[model samples]
Target: MVWRQHRIIRLNIVVLLYLMVCFVLCPVSAMTVSSPAEVHSVRGNAVTLTCTFTSTSRATSRMSVDWSYRPQTGGPPQAFFHFSSLAFPPQDGQFNGRVKWLGSPARGEASIQLLNASLSDNGTYTCSVRNPPDVHGSPTSQTVLTVTPKVPTVRFSDVAVLLAFILLPSAIITLALLGRMCCPPRDKSQTQGYHSPIEVTPGDEPGFKQINRKEKNMTCCDLYFLVWPFFFFCS
Candidate 1:
C-alpha cells in the first residue's frame, strides 16, 4: 500500500512538470483558434475568412494575431497580415491593398475580408493568435477559400416581364398605325356619287317626257298584236 501511494504521487508530479514546461515555452499565449474548413466566393467579389479563438488568460493589448496564405499550387506560406495592438496590413504581393482586417482581440475574434478576389486567389489561409502568460493550445487554424466564376443574371422571368410591359404593346401600336396609313376609310356619300353614271333633271325637258309616253304606248300595242295570233288559232 505504501509503495502504491508513492508511485501515484510521483506520477501526478511528473504530469504537472510537463504542463509547466509546455506553458513556459509559449508564455505569451495559450489560445486555440478555429475556422471553417471551406469557404466559397465569386470572382471579382469579396469573401470573409473567420477565425475565432479563446485564451487561457485574460485579454490584453499585447495580444497578437497573424494571418498567412498558401496557394493551391503548393508553395511556402506567405505572411500577409499582423495585428499587435494595431493593424499591420500586407505591403507587397497580390494581396497588397486587397486585404482588410476585421478582428477584435479583446472579444477573441480574428477575421479578415479579401476584396476583389480572382481565380488565382484560391488557396489556404491560416490564422494564429497569441495572448500573454497562458499555456499555448492549438494556436493556429486554417481555411480553404475557393473562387468561382460569376453566373449570368439574366432569367426567363425577366424576359417575360420585358415583353409583356414593353415589346408587345409597342408592336401592337405600330401595326395599328401602319394599317391606318396603308388603307384609309372612305365616306359613304363620296362612294355613292362616284358609282352613278349620269345625273338627270326630271322636269327640265318636254322632249324627254314625250319620248317616254310614246315608248310606253308602243310597248302595249306590240303586246296586243303578239297575243291576237294565238287567240285566232284557238277559235
Candidate 2:
C-alpha cells in the first residue's frame, strides 16, 4: 500500500508541471481600453480625444486602432481614423484635413486631435484597439465632446452703459467732496456785525476855568498846554 501511494503522488506532480508549461507557452486573451467620459471645447479651437489601452502582451505591427464618431443629433457611427503600423488620418467628408494622430503606440496610446473644432463636431467618439492575441477584455471605449460657441466680448455700448450707471454717480460724489475740501462755506456768526450800548456821565467832564479877556489874548500853543493838563487830570 505504501508503494502504490508513492506512485500516485509522483503522477500528480508530473501532471501539475505539464499544465504549468502549457499555460506559459500560450498567449493570454485579455485587454482593456480607457477614455474620458466627456470632453469640452470652444468653437474654432483644437481639441483632443484622449484614449489609452493595456494588454497582456506588447503592441506590434499587427496591432490596429480605429476611431469613429456619432453625431450628437443621433446617427450611426462613422469611421474617421485608422492606425496599424502607421497612422491614417481622415482626408474626406467633414473630417477632411482636420483629424490628427497624437498617440504613441509604444506606450499603448491611441488618442487623436481635431483642429478648428466647430459646433458640428460636438458628438460621441469611439476608440477601438485590437492587439491581436489579446481579445478577452473590452477593447473599445467612447467619450462625448461638446463644442460651445465663444462668448461675445464687451462692446463700446456696454462700457458706456456701465459708465452711466456706475462711474457717473462716482464722479458726482468725488466732485462734491472736492468742492467741500477746496471751497468750504462761510460761518454766519463770523460774517455778521455785532454792537453793544455805551454809558456816558457828566462827571467825566472837567470843570473848565472861564476864559476872560486875559486868556483870549493868549496864543493857540499857550491855550493847548493849559487844556492838556486838565484833560489828563479828568481821565
Candidate 3:
C-alpha cells in the first residue's frame, strides 16, 4: 500500500509540471526573427534593410533592437544602429546621419533605411530583436547588401560618334534611293546621235573610199569633241 501511494504522488507531480510548461513556457518558445536573404541598391539612393519578429506576448518599451555591419574587407562586425525607447544611430562614422529607424513594434516591423548609399556600403548586415519572456527562438537575422555604382552619363562626343557610324550611312542610303525614284536615268539609246560617213584613203592614198559612220564605232566623247569645233565656228 505504501508503494502504491508513492506512485500516485509521482504521477501528480508529473501532471503539475506538464501544466506549468503548457501555460507558461510554450509562449516563450514561439518567438522567432526573420530578415531578407539579400538586398540590392544603387549608389546615391536609399536602401532598406527589413527585419521582422514573431512573439506570443505584446511588445513593450523594454524590448530592444540592434543593427550591426561587417565590411567586405573582413573584420569584426560593428554596431551601427540601436533602438529601445529611442533610436541611437551612429553619431560619427560611415553611417552617421544616414541611418534612420522606420519600424513599429506593434506592427512587427524593425526595418532601417540608409540614405545616399555608396559602394563602400556593400557588406553583411545583422538585425537582432530581444523581448523578455519571448527569447527562446533565434533573435538575430542576417542579410547581404550589395551597393552598385551609378552608371556614367552619356557625353556629346559619344552621340556624335554614333551618328557618324550609324545614322550618317543610313541617311545617305535613303537619300540615294529617293533620288533614283524621283529622277530616273535617261535612256542611252534615245541620246545616240547620227554620224555622217567620212572619206578615207587606203595604204597608197591614191584612191578614195567612203567609210560608214556605223563601222567606225565612235564613242560619245569622240562625237562631243567633233561637234564642239563646229559649234564654236558657227558661234
Candidate 4:
C-alpha cells in the first residue's frame, strides 16, 4: 500500500509539471527573434544590424523594439535605441548621433544603422522585441559587429586612366618610328642619281654663243670666236 501511494504522488507531480510548462513557459517561448551571427564593416562607414521576430499574435500599437550594445571587454549591455510609434535613438554615448533606426516593427523588422562606425564600436549588439500578447518567446537576438580599418584600394578607372595617359602615348611613338624605319620614302635624290647627265647642245653651253638671224652673214665659227672670246677677255 505504501508503494501504491508513492506511485500516485509521482503521477500527480508529473501532471503538475506538465501544466506549469503549458501555462507558463509555452507563451514565453512562442515569439522567436533572429539576427545575423556576425557582421563586418569598415571604419567610418555605415553598418546595418538587422533583427526580426515572429509572433503567434498580430501586430499592435504596443509592439516595441529595443537595441543594446556590449563592449568586447565584456560588461553589462547598454541600451542605445528604442522604437514603438517613434524612434528613440542613442543620445549621448559612444554611439551618440551615430545610430539610426531603419526598421519597421509592423513588418517584423527591428534593424538599425550605425553611421561612422569606428574601432571603438567593435562589440556585440542585442535586439529585443515585444508585441502585446506575443511578447514572450525568444524576444532577444544578438549580433557580433566587427569594425575593421578601411584599406586603401586601387580602382579600375584610375588604372585605365594611368595606362591611357602614359603607356598609350609611348606605344604610338614606338609604332611611328618602326613604320619610318621599315618603309623608307622615295626621295628625289635617290632616283635622280641613277639618271644620265642632262644633254647639252652648243647653244646650251655657257662659253659658246650662236649668231642671231640679223647676223646670219657671219660664219658659225667666226661668230663663236668673236662673241665668246671677246666676252672672256673683257672679264
Candidate 5:
C-alpha cells in the first residue's frame, strides 16, 4: 500500500508539472495595438487613432483599455483615457471638449477621435489593456502623435481677380513703352522726299534750276503736315 501511494503521488506531481508547462507556453488573452504606429493631425482638424486586438478568452467585455501619454523626454505617463463602469472621464486641459471615444468597448474597439487638434497634443501615446488577476498586468503599446500647422491656400478665383486688378494696367503700360522704344517715328520731311530748296549762283544758273521761296515754303509745310500723323501715332 505504501508503494502504491508513493507511485500515485509521483504521477500526480508529473501531471501537475505538465499542466504548469502548458500554462507557461499558452499565449495570453489580451488586446494588441494594430494601427497608427505613427499618426499626424493638423491644427483645427479632427484625427482618429485606431487600435485592434483579439483574445481567445470570452471575457473581453469585462476588460478595460487605458490610453495615456508619455513625453519623449521620459516622465510619468499622463492619463488620457480609461474604461470602467461604461464611463470615460472629462478630457484633460488642452483636449477638453475635443476628445471622444469612437465606439463601444464590448466590440474590442478602442479608437479615439480628437477634434480641433492643436500643437500641445503632440506626444507619445500608449494603449494598455487590463483584465484583473486572471491575466498579467496590461502591456503597453506606444504611438507617436504629431501635430502640424495647417498651411493657408489661396483660391483660384481670388488669385485671378488679384492678377487682373494689380497686373493688367502694369502690363499695358509695359507694352506701350516697349513699342515706343522698338519702333521710333521718322521726321516727316525726310521720309516724304521733301527737302528745302537751295539758291543757285548767278554763274551756275545754267546748270541748276532755281526754286521760288513761296513754293519751297509751301512744300515744306505740306510735308510737315503729312508727317504729323506718324508723330501723333507714336505719341
Candidate 6:
C-alpha cells in the first residue's frame, strides 16, 4: 500500500508539471501601436490612427475592437468606439459626423480616421482588442488630438530662409575681403614706363644737343642721365 500511494503521488506531480508546461507554452496575442502616437488635426482636415497586431489564428469579422478615451489627468476610460455587429455610432458632440473607420475589419485592421477634427476632441485615446476565448485584454495605446488655429506662416524668419538671404551673402562678402587682403594690388605707378636698358639709345629723340660732361651750368636732364646707372643698380 505504501508503494502504491507513492506511485500515485508521483503521477499527480507529473500531471501538474504537464499542465504547467502547457500553460507556459501558450502563445500570447500581440498588438502593436505605431509611432507618433499623438497627432495634430486641423479643424477642416482629417487624420488617421494606425495600429498593427499578430496572432497564430486568422482574425475574423466577428472580432471585437474597442477604442476609448481618457482625459490626460486620468480617469475611467470612455467608450468612443466598438466593433462587433458591424455597427458604428455617430461621432459625439465635437467629433459629430467626422470620425470614420479606416480599416477593413475583415483583414484584421483597426485604424480610425478623424475628419474635421476640433479643439474639443483634444484628449487621450486608447485602443483595445478582444479575440474571443483565447484573448480578451486591453493592450492600450494613447494619443493626444490637438486642434490648431490656422495662422499665416512667416517664411522670412525661417532658419533656411535666413541662411540663404543673410548668412550666405555675409559669408561671400567675408571671403572676398579675405582674398583682397591676401593678394595686394599691383603698383601701376612703378611699372608705368619701364624701358629695357638695351632698348634705350642715346639721343633717341631729336633733342637740342648732347653736351659733354666737362660743360658747366648742368640742367636737370643732365643730372638724370648721370644718375641713371645708379638708379638702375639700386632698383
User: Alpha carbon lDDT of residue 189, candidate 6?
Assistant: 60
State the lDDT of candidate 3 residue by residue for 129-218, as single tens digits. Answer: 988878678899999999998889999999889878886676556556655654455455533433334542333222211223332555
Candidate 4 lDDT tens digits, 1-235: 9999999999999999999989886654378999999999999999999898888777777888999899988999999898988998877988899988888766788899999999999899999998877745688999999999999999999988977788667655654665555435645563333432376553454323322332354444554455455434532
Full-model lDDT for every candidate: 0.81, 0.82, 0.81, 0.79, 0.66, 0.63
lDDT of 5 by residue, 130-212 (tens): 55433643346778989999999999999788767766665556556655654456455543443344664443543223323
TM-scores for candidates 1 onward, in order:
0.60, 0.58, 0.58, 0.59, 0.58, 0.49
lDDT, candidate 2, 1-235, per-residue tens: 9999999999999999999998999747699999999999999999999999998788999899999999999999999999999999887889999988998888989999999999999899999999988988999999999999999799999988987888667655654665565445645564342432244243332221222333455454554555556534532
Highest-scoring model, TM-score: 1
Off by over 4 Å in 5: 1-31, 59-61, 131-138, 176-235
Candidate 1 residue pairs that clash: 28-131, 28-132, 30-135, 30-136
Q: Could you give candidate 1's per-residue lDDT for residues 107-186 as a string of tens digits?
A: 88999999999999999999988777654588899999999999989898998898788866765565466556543564
Rank all candidate structures by their lDDT, best first, as comma-separated numbers: 2, 3, 1, 4, 5, 6
lDDT tens readout by residue for model 6, 1-235: 9999999999999999999998789756554433247788776678787655444456665467777767656688788777775747456655457668766555656778877766666777777665554363345556777778766676755967877777667655654665465444645664354556576665452221322222344544555466456534532
Q: So what's the TM-score on candidate 6?
A: 0.49
**RMSD in angstroms, candidate 1?**
20.6
Q: Give lDDT: candidate 3, residue 206.
A: 27
- Stretches of candidate 4 exceeding 4 Å from the true structure: 1-29, 172-235
Error of 1 at 55 (Å): 1.2
RMSD of each: 20.6, 22.2, 13.4, 19.8, 10.5, 16.3
